[model samples]
Target: MIFGSERQQHKILRKNHQMEEGSSHEITSPLLSNKEEELEDEKNEEDVVEIDENENSPIKQVALTVPTTDDPSLPVLTFRMWVLGTLSCVLLSFLNQFFWYRTEPLTITAISAQIAVVPLGQLMAAKITTRTFFRGTRWEFTLNPGPFNVKEHVLITIFANSGAGTVYAIHVVTAVKVFYQKHISFFVSLLVIFTTQVLGFGWAGIFRRYLVEPAAMWWPANLVQVSLFRALHEKEKRTKGSLTRSQFFVVAFLCSFAYYVFPGYLFQMLTSLSWICWIFPHNVLAQQLGSGLYGLGIGAVGLDWSAISSYLGSPLASPWFATANVAAGFVFVMYVLTPLCYWLNVYDAKTFPIFSDDLFKSNGQIYNITEIIDSNFHLDYAAYERQGKLHLSTFFAMTYGVGFAALTATIVHVGLFHGREIWEQSKSSFKEKTMDIHTKLMSRYKQVPEWWFVCILIATIAITIFTCEYYNDQLQLPWWGVLLACGIAIFFTLPIGIITAITNQTPGLNIITEYIIGYIYPGYPVANMCFKVYGYISMTQAITFLQDFKLGHYMKIPPRTMFMAQVVGTFIAGFVYLGTAWWLMETIPDICKDTSSVWTCPSDTVFYDASVIWGLIGPRRIFGDLGTYSKVNWFFLGGAIAPFLVYVAAKAFPQQEWIRLINMPVLIGATGMMPPATTVNYTSWIIAGFFSGFVVYRYRPEWWQRHNYVLSGALDAGLAFMGVLLYLCLGLEDVSINWWGNDLDGCPLAHCPTKKGFAVEGCPIFT
Candidate 1:
């Protein structure tokens, strides 16, 4: 297949300049002068050659960030790599799963492990003996072949990336056991986790040529890691007034570590500084507008880096153009649409809290989900009818509509903007002439055999079918459901992968998968959850695997080695994730409940709510003919049409290059994380994005290039380390200081309804 083809075709013109008349070494001058001049000229020539080679690629970001050269001699799969890489994977997996049940889940990215392993790798290289084993044999190896190098570091980071985030399948297990309070065997859960995690490897292998090798599919997020790798490894001279990159990283890391104590533990109010709520503490309307944790958060902002980057991600890594699109979308949704709808009482919005993800009755009381679930774990039709139609908070319903729009927008956007290019790429994928420099360099290493992926794909599918069918009483999903889920995952992997490859934003399949299976098999919550995991998370895992492959490609690591590392790391992470989660569930009392905020599983709560609404209750009762919010389905058409309009506008106004950059998918999907992500998250994320992406990148290009990504990595590493320390030292013991400063959400009235005569406790009833 054609690997690494560029979208934009640009030529770099070369110019050869003759040496100036007096600048050439003079015979009369000292021989030392001539030698110095000669060396300087050689260095200048080398710089020009490097620039020209890099510029040959059409994508500007790739040309700027990735290095043009490669060192094949550097050992990648060394003894140190296995030791450090495996350890990093296991530790990160355990830590991430451990933190996933918290009030604000801290996702410790691979960047932290990337930074932490450098010292350990070097220490091993320094201390271990270099004596070779099995001398004169083809299988000879040594404890330390050489000093720690960048290649080994990249592989370890990839290994860590495999386990950086909590395993998606674990959510299924949590939803079934803790939320549903059902008895599920650990073997079934393990099978589900391993199968779901590995199932995506098939999709990744099939689409690697399109997603990983394309020069135009730059995968912008990888640039941050690439920049960090260069900063940590490349030697640099400290400028006259500025600190060296390493020195700056150290200073930033320490400051970030020290500052997290306020928002993380001691003064938790710093996480969401809703000063407006503080001024009018008793005013429901005022608190609703000002609260950062709930409501619209009109005037809210955060001081905590975790609150900013938790859901939205580090804004420093996003490109200026993409960030601007996301900012516009957030404002349109949170500021304009939400306020207008809630005040107008769209879908009886004011009957419930202005912003909530919880299911409710018509009178604003929380829905009793257990009442509608029968002994068979199916929907009790009589109980559901007695409870009447379920209702959602206005913001929650609107978010679903937006999700519908975003999914279609993604497909339409790709078809309109990238259709022709994709078609052409498919037609000429096998042509070797289309390969870019990175691809050419990678070609030297033996390519992974297609049969390996085929074997994995077949085996994973077989195991999944066996698990579902053999354990049908517990799983409730039939063998056919597994095949259908795989089909959906494989079908969307290409389009979704393209969007993620280009934009750093991934449009999720959670809603679509849940809706499809909910309609197809309505009564079983576990079945719907399992279907969503297999269909949605498999695609997610594929995209993640492709992202790592792109990182490996940029670092010039061998494909086979990359494959091996990912497979091993994924298996290790799956076991660790399951173990940690099981331990926490067993040890913690009242976990995933209101009694303990520290272990109140936010994401899992949302997942369980979804199971009730879509599975136990079924969409036919909520969004179908019998549902009150049926009109929201019109968003599908709106989403489809929105991108076409953008496409027409870009064509009609070709001179306005900015029109082409208006991404509808990103714009519509911008608020996808809203229920879980509050106002402070988006507001703080936007501010950081604007300052770093636009301000620094526009006015101070040199400084932005030198320090921006390094700063991002440092902040992440510091927060991760400090968060773990706090949890271990204080959180586990429930040793918290109770005071105003420790109050995370200062707006007590934010969750209260403003509707007339609501009669809810803790709020003044409107008369």
Candidate 2:
């Protein structure tokens, strides 16, 4: 609402300035020149955004104000603009969903929204909405508490609703339900998303002063936000030239309705294009040749890996760095550990070395691999089932082991390494000076706070408990377990996240977490569920923090407002995300014989939140007879820990210089650990980081310092709009090319692999 209202205020200001300035240009020139000269003199005397310890900090005088009834009409949109922006976001959201949904039956996955595309549409809409409706009327938009304001609601909703990151969240919940034939109610899903999921936002705020502000830390995604704000507000400042604002309420209503219906039907027509499929498929050629585009595809496919990748590349870097650490994980799990069992000839690798679902059977029936290994080696399948997925006790032991070593190593390195810059930033003068630019920015926009997020968390938790009790009382675990999972996840994940954020990388954590869940909950769903919840919450929070931090990079909203906006966004999103998630789960069953179809089901093991739960917590429950000494755990653990080692290595020998070269921990981890076949993640990372880094580091200019976010904003906006069209045209139908695998014949777009052994197919969208 603040965003929308701001547009209106900006319009009035511009109109008044234009009218008055136009009438007296000749007479006012001398006076204006004198004033300009005086301001120039002041700039020389003191930096525009600089701090002065001798005087009260420039920001101290500025106070936050709320909207009052005096300008009630002024604060609201004229109905049209509000409708248009809202409609645009909704259309984009739905289109994103249709494009990514796989139409195949017999595939045990559900069709869910393309999480990434929604954000792009929102990003695009942020600019379009602001520019089209609020350009000169920023002040007219109210920041006061009241019923929904179009501007704020649109921005927050877009921020909240857009992005495939939610898929990971849904996947977790879906996996658990599918595994046990249990469903999480909409309320439970909301509880999981809003409460525990957003706690990381608070933690992110705690570190905001350090990551953002003077450090000028770059979070590219926020550039989109900053761009939108500046573009809309620039007219008031007279930094850019002129356009009338769109009729607010008119466009808003239209766009919202258009968004809702277009994706429902129109997407079927758009997805028939050939170019999309030629560029993004699952084959090796597509994987290798189009990997760069694959990352772009993420944007179009409605998977917001860019945000996550950006976060990992800089501020919240764990998962990305996990890419680098994955190599070590592979070495330890596959090469070092699994081989030990094979050396003893426990099981015949020559016959069945590569892992398969039925390792001990010739066909579907069981066999005697265990018998042969009994005399020389032993594996406890019974013990495996009893323990279920990796348990918490195991996670605790490993985390302690890893954290103990990492913390000691990191502290020593920090003392020896970045101690000076840290010291400099701590100085009152420096802090004050740095805080000044942001202080001036505070008067520019609406403010939200940390407490709002806290409240949202509480409310979400309450809702989840109520939902769980109502839907599946028998499957419920103690609330403490959930809380404990969140607590441990938050503590353990922060440093890793921070490291990744700075380095623009992430060390893998999924495997380790899975193994841990297997150890703690054992045979119950409790451990698995907790692990999934914690994993999604931790990662999403870290990413969101980075996003907010990036927003701060350009604008000067107090840490409080940024936090509050996030809460507002999250609270709003929680219900929408859950409602859609439940709708898909509930509605998809009747359309296709295979409820697991990626297009029809809401719970695909690969893409759903439940995947993590299943892999980490339910795998052992379902397939525990698999050996822990197998190469999987060893390699997986190695990948998870690589970044810690890299960090230590970087700190210990600053001169070695290779450390700086290898900043992309996630990239390295991916290349090193994931079988080379899985290069999609790395390729995507490289492509994304390349453009972002180029824009921020090489292209940044000294002038227009306050408005540097425009480029990024424009790019994201353009891409998002294009992405909407992409999904609309080709995303809704079962029309992808078949190469490696396919769905059942009767099912839409379903085909079995032709035995060419899984590779990318070009004609997926067109065929």
Candidate 3:
């Protein structure tokens, strides 16, 4: 078995209006729970999770749960564990990177590992019994070491999750060659990807004391995965009146698998239905409001469960209080706020498409940045002067301002709310008995050294500096600019990590790095991208790595062993993701343009546009005094204060329990998630959320416990199973069955735009 591995995966979040778009990969981080009774009181704050909700009780737990791993002695670093983890890592990495270039940019989570590793492990266990397979030879060893246990399963998941998506740097790598026509060496791309990812390990390794060691820093998402593992491996007597978890999981899995065929392949229109679009096919306003796939959904609904759950999360796992917060914020912002502004023609938005992030000329045509960008990828002042300024849709402009507010609000919110606690936790790291039982158990094992991460950070930094400095055509970044990028990541990691560790949401560094670096490294588009990948991706990678660290701690895997697996796995994934991107680029024709083709680089277009705005033209040129949308900059101040006021309100009016649930970061942060996603997603997600969190948890407690997370795993598995089957059977033949029978799920007019006279370039492309 290999002792060390590096893992890297990619997930691109979509940005609309000012930001890029939502996530490139839908992160299936599973939900909240704990076994400690004293921690039940910790549920008072929804933002702060301390325990899992009681399984037998009728309510959802406000805090994250801490469950004990059943077995600690089982050898986690074994022949079978190594083989399975590595294989799954490579395959999923390939799969995600392949889909990453598509117009829709669909990708699955390492939750697939949770589903696949088990059955495969069980099969291997059955075939490789201790006495039979390696019976006579001293050289032979049994791959099956006792019943396949929780630790092995968990280590496998960590490996998969680490390598699940393309490393964030791939977007920068892809855009340089594909969008900017800059050539890059294989080594340069690989080194950049590896450095952007591994550099974060230093921060994660250091912060483990604060984020992973504390009992209160429960990673709420891991609880769902924990519950599923228990349901599968642990034996419990079946109640006479209730369906067993296995039984419910089986039923839900098959049903979901069968239903997916319709919306996923056969009847695509089943994804969304907009009666308004059908009734008023030629009306641009009706199209804008009712086109489920193309516009904001007005009186729209989706039949596909995946589409419903895509934006938020699985309804079964999300607690109602959290769900309600997401729902209320999504609605009030997207439906009420966005529509009102657009109708009022805010920003003279009526002249442009209702929703888009693509820069456009003031005259309502897609703003061609090539005209403004010179051959060296620098902004041409004369060309820019001639073109005037770009125009953003009303909703798009609104999101930018809101995004500014969200960034500052998160910093202020964390400082006011969790600053004192973080300081104390740092103190508690050296003090005995201050840590949780999980931490105590983990402390017994040999830990990975801070020096290892330090070595990684120093090495990757050297490689990156060389890449940026020597390869100016591709990177356009100075050596000091590299340092500044890293500095931004280091500065934000603690606060952002604190936030995600408590509440699963991460207020990303993407918007800020682009905004700030745009100002500093003005006119150097590639430098802006380099800054973003290093600053934003590095921090996110650190936090995610910390999440896995906490996971290994919970499962009681040796820290050193876990570290080795990730180091090896991430390195392999870097190769795999790069290869897949290269393959797609080489094969796909008319990519990033022909949306009708699967290869259209919808997400990368956002990436290109962002570089043009923040990197090429610079923020000073766009949002500064010379810009048309200068008022949006005031949001920095507004965001900084909003969270402070929210905290004061919660503290001042202590009686208003509802005020405590109003997480300012999440509410404002959601505005940024809009675009490239429709109102139907919000509608469907909220519906599922209320059903599971409110109805099922409240009305049928027993049912919720036996099946919630288990069912989620099964549904994911079933959908995947069917997808594989369909693709192999028909997709390999390059046959996508297209028909008008169930077109847009009975809403042909759904894409009709309501407004007339003005040509909204790219208006055809809905959110």
Per-residue lDDT for 14-121 in model 1, tens only?
Answer: 111111111121112111234543443443221112123433446766665676556565788899999999999998998899889988898899989999999899
**Rank by lDDT, descending?**
1, 3, 2
lDDT of 3 by residue, 16-120 (tens): 101211212222211112232233333332221122223211212312223432233366876668888998889888887876776544456677777788888
Identify the runs in model 2 with alpha carbons over 4 angstroms from their true place: 1-167, 176-180, 214-216, 224-436, 439-475, 503-509, 558-564, 589-603, 607-658, 664-668, 671-681, 684-767
Q: Against the correct fold, how does model 1 do in TM-score?
A: 0.93
In the order shown, what is each candidate's alpha-carbon RMSD?
A: 6.1, 12.5, 10.1
Could you tell me which 10 consecutive residues in candidate 1 have the lowest summed lDDT?
8-17
TM-score of 3: 0.87
Clashing pairs in 1: 2-429, 4-213
- Top model number, lDDT: 1
Give the candidate number with the greatest TM-score. Answer: 1
Which stretches of model 3 miss by more than 4 angstroms? 1-66, 129-144, 741-756, 759-767
Winner on TM-score (2 vs 3): 3
**Rank list by TM-score:** 1, 3, 2
Report the C-alpha displacement of residue 440, candidate 2, in angstroms: 6.5
TM-score of 2: 0.55
Question: Of the pair 1 and 2, which is ahead by TM-score?
Answer: 1
